[model samples]
Target: MAYQSLRLEYLQIPPVSRAYTTACVLTTAAVQLELITPFQLYFNPELIFKHFQIWRLITNFLFFGPVGFNFLFNMIFLYRYCRMLEEGSFRGRTADFVFMFLFGGFLMTLFGLFVSLVFLGQAFTIMLVYVWSRRNPYVRMNFFGLLNFQAPFLPWVLMGFSLLLGNSIIVDLLGIAVGHIYFFLEDVFPNQPGGIRILKTPSILRTIFDTPDDDPNYNPLPEERPGGFAWGEGQRLGG
Candidate 1:
């Protein structure tokens, strides 16, 4: 329950099945504030200092260093995975479900940043996987697309790329690490042992959207996964 500190049970009783709805809202807000670029946020001390906003982390999540044309498509993929995660955990209280995923993303980013300063390349090892980790928690990931399944271990894959690329590649790795921590610490670790200590949603919301109900928005994702329920559930971002 120590982690329950990140609660947002008020969004929806069960919250919404698709977390992208929230992502969209947050992203939109950042765009409106003209903070969509890395220059405006990561380097701008004046804006952040002037706002005096405590939750500056939220602002950072809104800015990505771009992934070429794959950005929009990948974000959509992230939303899909997040939606499923929210629905599965929240059940009736979708808000908590959404919060869990969103929080995981936020936490991983922070953790990645922290670790990057010390072990730059290692931070990304966690980031790549999270990007396509919707099915990551499963013992065996059913990749969204493809005939068979595989651990879309994007984090590590990206890490390999970073080690080869050098220097500037650190930021991308750090970004993915941030997303990985959110899921690993909050869900995977506690739930690891044999029976009782597994992570379980606290039944927080009132009423909300249920998942796998075949909602129209329910899309088929082309997700990547790691090994086991949380095996190296990680990835490194492309810079």
Candidate 2:
């Protein structure tokens, strides 16, 4: 019999996964272009904007290279959050999350350049994503097979490290502001007639994007989180 997809729940996506993936790829491609030198990449739109490359925006996610702990943390965080989001948002609305992430990162990067704190672009990225993650604090992950931990520690810890490294905090603060405004406008009045139904109620804003109620049938393990990636078992044990 012809069947309709279950509409019992929707999927979600953590904001950082796309941008962090984008940053790593950009760094790798920069090196490939013989632009590996320390000073070459700074304020280099050629790499960030992909030399006016029309396809750069999409390619950025695949352009990453290892940048020490940042890359490792990203891999782990992405697995956990992406799965959680997918499980939470069931009607395949993960695309909306990605849109917010990319646009938010772009806004932060723009502000970073305007204020001359170009170096802390990544810091701003985490801030933009973390604010949303906090709203859904019930989310948790196993800490490297050690302990079950939550509270969105990765983003906040990274921010602290950035501060200790003498990086600019204003950029991150400003990025959060930009994300807040973006979230508001995206929901309350979207273009498509049915778009509002898929809209997220972010916790940061008092009214909209609040912690959306968990679906009664929402089983983070089977039906949602790992179904696409087949992460059913991995997700259950807390990856």
**Candidate 2, residues 1-239: lDDT per residue as tens digits?**
12323323222233334345445556755675667633443443456565654343333333323455555554444444454544454223445555565566566556655675434444434544554454444555343344444544545554555587685657556755674566456633476665554445354442432344543553453322432332111222233
lDDT tens readout by residue for model 1, 1-239: 64463342323312342333455446545665676644444423344458764344444444333543334433444444444444444334554554554555445544544443322212322343454353443323333232233345544444554565563555555556565555565556667675243334454432343343544433332223444332222232331
Residue 166 lDDT in candidate 2: 87
Q: Which stretches of candidate 2 lie over 4 Å from their true place?
A: 1-66, 78-83, 119-121, 124-128, 139-157, 183-239
TM-score of 1: 0.46
Candidate 1 runs further than 4 Å off: 1-40, 43-51, 66-80, 83-93, 105-149, 162-239
The TM-scores, one per candidate, come to 0.46, 0.47
Residue 59 in candidate 2 has what lDDT? 36
